[model samples]
Target: MAAPAHTFTHDGIAFGGDYNPEQWHPSVWEEDVALMREAGVDLVAINIFGWAAVEPRSGEFTFASLDRVIELLHAAGIRVNLGTGTASPPAWLTLAHPEILPIAEDGTTRYPGGRQAWCPSSPAFRTAALSLVRAVAERFGSHPAVALWHVSNELGCHNALCYCDQSAAAFRRWLRARYNSIDALNAAWGTAFWSQTYSDWDEILPPRAALSARNPGQALDFHRFSSDELLDYYRAEAAVIRDLSDVPVTTNFMVAAHIENMDYWQWAGEMDVVANDHYLDYRLGDPRTELSFAADLSRGLALGSPWLLMEHSTGAVNWQPINFAKSPGQMLRNSLTHVARGADAVCFFQWRASLQGSEKFHSAMLPHAGTDSELWREVVELGAILSKLDEVAGSRVVADIALVFSWESWWAADAESRPSTAIGYLDQVHAVYAAFAALHMTMDVVAPGADLSEYKLVVVPGLHLVRNEEAAIINDWIADGGTALVTFFSGIVDENDRVWAGGYTGPFRDALGVAVEEFAPLAPDSRVSLDSGATGTKWSERMRVTTAEVVDAFADGPAAGSPAITRNRWGSGNAWYLSTLLEPEEYRSLALQLAAEAGVDSPVRVSGDAEGAVEVVRRRGDLASYVFAINHSNTSVQLQVSGTELITGDNNAGHNTAGHNTAGDNTVATVEVPPGAVRIIREESAS
Candidate 1:
């Protein structure tokens, strides 16, 4: 498979990260730039939070501080990713137009002390923000240092939803454009049941706090509008940047596990290049798996294009309750893992640790201890490593398996009045994704509506809201010999969050050859075993088989002997319906079995003699295939593969160290990958 298309203004993988030189004095700028060059920092993201510094007052702009920083970096031969600094409006703008402030659902307005305090729907905020963007672009658009235009810092980070009158008015306008009329809005929002029918367009309001339960359809639409509102904000800034500068534009996406509201798949189309900021949640989940999930999702948003790792912490982040620092070598491993997943640029949150303000404690390349710190040494070492691995840039991970993940379904399923509140959309999806990861499989976390024909196996887990057109796409893909595994609570609602009248799993009932009679939500203490030895918890559905054969039955439960797992052949393809959430091992077994049935395997498979500790990922470039052997366990792993180690000089005997088929025959070799280390090898072909 060919790699996805990407535009690179720089030749090699760009490093360095958010550099707030304005925070420090002008005297510190020279030393900072010198240190960055010594550490192999080629790129620095600047002006991210410089709204107040650039434009101190209304209708006035000054770029002396920013100009000095840019010049210093440019003189040092370090490229700049110019940020628009529109994410946080200046204090004067907010004070002049207080209406631009975002109001919470509880009717409290957010002040300008914190960032992202402006309402996305506020016209004044948009005008002010665009004016600043235009000013900045006009000033530095053609500058030799400016390589990329960062639209805004993580758009809609805090002000995703605004319940104020301005937002309500904007929401009504958006609804008018979408539904066209009040009657259409009423129908789409299902307002008749609650006697909440709208008589006039002015009668409609933003889904705010109410004494009674809010409309799910209204909330869903609000979610869509909020996401679009932020996208519009990004587009507005990007439009100005494009008009003034030919540089590529991007906004850092917070694709962390906790990010909600914004639909990145739709937002990806508006960006010149996709960039993501991922922060690991050490308190809740394993950092490695979370990083893998975020990076894969980001790459998928770019359509397998080499995206930017815009922001990540070198160690502890200040915002989390427990700011745990990374151990030795953890940061390097984290950076390499992102590269293995398709991130061309590996960057961090900031270059230097803050001495004051909220993020003073957050770790950075230059920590509080400066050059004397071990973190600083590690940062220099990682910079050296990235400088050497330039050959791996722009390569794409080749995967025959695709996991369909949707933010819309995540919102709908998590909405109130569901089959079970315990049904986490990502949790279900992650269980399946983790199983694939354990098997060293390279899978893309694609959108539900993306092109699926390229993938041999597609897994859709907990897709609660299935639009008619999306269902048709999946059904057509299955009929065309594509293997699909869809789980419970899927195909329940339509595009407007309305349930199909006949039964659950509306559009999927016919496709899966099974009809869900009712949802049997298991208690926390409850358990059910499948005939396939898969124990299910949290959820199970009672279904009656129609044209499908039962692959697994509920061994014991309220729905005992019912079809828990069914398989049906449609046209030339097959569809598997997992009616319950299975354990990781069982899910892995089922996933592997289905993959084998579909004739899908990882690009590089480990020998059977070794346990599955080292994970392998293959990315194909124009010249060769890049294989990443990552040891995630605490012990060493022996990996036998046909490739040349790109980082380390060591290679197994009897194999071509040049990574070419010199004798017209392939050679196999075994090497021990140490725990928590990564080995990137280059093979001639992906096969």
Candidate 2:
């Protein structure tokens, strides 16, 4: 068999999670280790929030406890992912340096009651954080068991806009670097309209609720500034660790996290690898939506390279309004989903449940009673399965489809009201994603400026803030035979949120072969059917088709029978224009037609029954490939497995027919997969 492209070769997928020995006694360490061994846990992320213990005073530090924990784990033959412990500042640091406390939007200083309360622009916080990181690195940089360096916990503040004096000053500097001149800034911000032009750097302030009616340009810049400030803090801490050690460093970013602009593309460059926390309410059916987007984003961050699954709740999250427990096979399936989607390792928010504090009710390997529970058994089983498939670890799966996910576009489009409030930036992106998901088409969600040569089809959901260079790049790709999907509300603004005055889509008008004259935001209950004979709801954009053919049209409203969806042919490529919010069914139908045009094949042959309840991911090599089918439903479903089951080692289950290869082939072999069950098939060489 051909060597797998992306697989976990080291015993199995790394199992174990965030371990906080500081919260427990030394006597409890032995028991925790034993429980970990029982659960086949080989890796432990240690010292995530142990800053208080690591640094007791300003200059004085203590590494004795941490040293002992690392030594013990190493002795037990377990790998350690050492954390810098800078996420939550110690009480003393906060009390001594009052600037560390972030200033809320109302200009009120927030007390340090919760973590992530530190002001990113605070010099005292930076100095103290860098000192502790340097100390940790100096002590354990070369530890034998150390595998990676985790920078901080989550790296997001509940209240993001810090209107403090320090933040305000930093925002001015950031704006200066971006705009260069006050006149340029004024022109870009259109401050002449509101008479809010700035005379000096000090006159500028952090955009807050108190100053709601400020210039859109200034407010947008403040958002970017705040994000950059926090990113600087992350970089500062990362630099400290890198100065002492060569181990890869990363901070866990929340999926769909909208705090400080955190452009993953820029942030991914600073760290050796990218990791993200995955927390979705199963009730919302958003796990498939969020995780798929997140996995693709992480993969895109490293240019299709594998990423770490840093933090996930094993069972229930206490923070949500209603804590729902993962069903019997749900946790295992979720972990495998991460691996199938390009995760290098699988770890959770916690290894052991906390006895006291806010996370006491959170689920973990060892429950609050300190006994081995179902969650522990599931963790062990997953570890064992990973061990058996160790050869598949560390391999990468190449994607032929790329969906454009831009932070700049999201920021700019949402900054001002143009089309409709119901059609949010994320919602539009997710609509395209849901379409792909329904068709069982695997795609990579990427940022702007990502390489377009690898993907045959490129979907830009909301390219609202298309820069001239980026637009040229897209046009070139389309001219070179790439199928481009551009949606409504796109090309409305430039990098500075300035409307592309000449036309709606700016430079993309010629590439799309169409011009949008006006936007029509439909009512919530509005309905429209396509001329291609499909129906949808919510909103639609009215456009004058310059050269494009109307593939679908609006069925109702003032613009009824108008072009709701258009197709334009440029060079040997095709451009699809969606002029409205499509219902789920309409989206799937249109997606199927687009996929066909792009020459992308669906992995799942049978559909409708398993529509959104299952997801398919394929990792292809030159000759062979592996297909993973995941059932995200709450009930068991039948899957026709033409290839042999990779995990079962049972080729007899599926039928063997003439003219078929050794991997097992059948016209139709119905395999009943339980809810949350993941099945992997090793496809035979097509050659």
RMSD of 1: 3.2
Model 1, 597-679: lDDT tens digits are 88887766554333465568888898888788877667766555656676674444215322323345655455566777878
Off by over 4 Å in 1: 1-6, 607-611, 651-667
- Models 1 onward score TM values of 0.95, 0.93
Model 1 — TM-score against the truth?
A: 0.95
Predicted model with the maximum TM-score: 1
**Model 2 over residues 1-687: C-alpha lDDT tens digits?**
112222222354677799999999999898888778877788899999999898888888998899888888888889998899988888898888887899877778788877877887889888888888998999988877888888877775464568888888888888889889988887888877756877877777777665344566676777777777777888788778778876767778766534336666666666666677787655454655666776777777766767778878778988777898888887877888788888878888788899899899999877765554676777778777767555456667656788888877777777654567766677788888888877778788777766788888888887888888888888889889989889888888887888888668787898888887777777777776666667666567667788899887887775676788888998878888888878787788888888888888766453335546787777664445666778877766555445656678655434552232235663465455566677776665421
- Candidate 2 matches the true fold with a TM-score of 0.93
Off by over 4 Å in 2: 1-12, 157-160, 257-260, 282-285, 369-372, 416-418, 604-608, 621-624, 634-644, 651-675
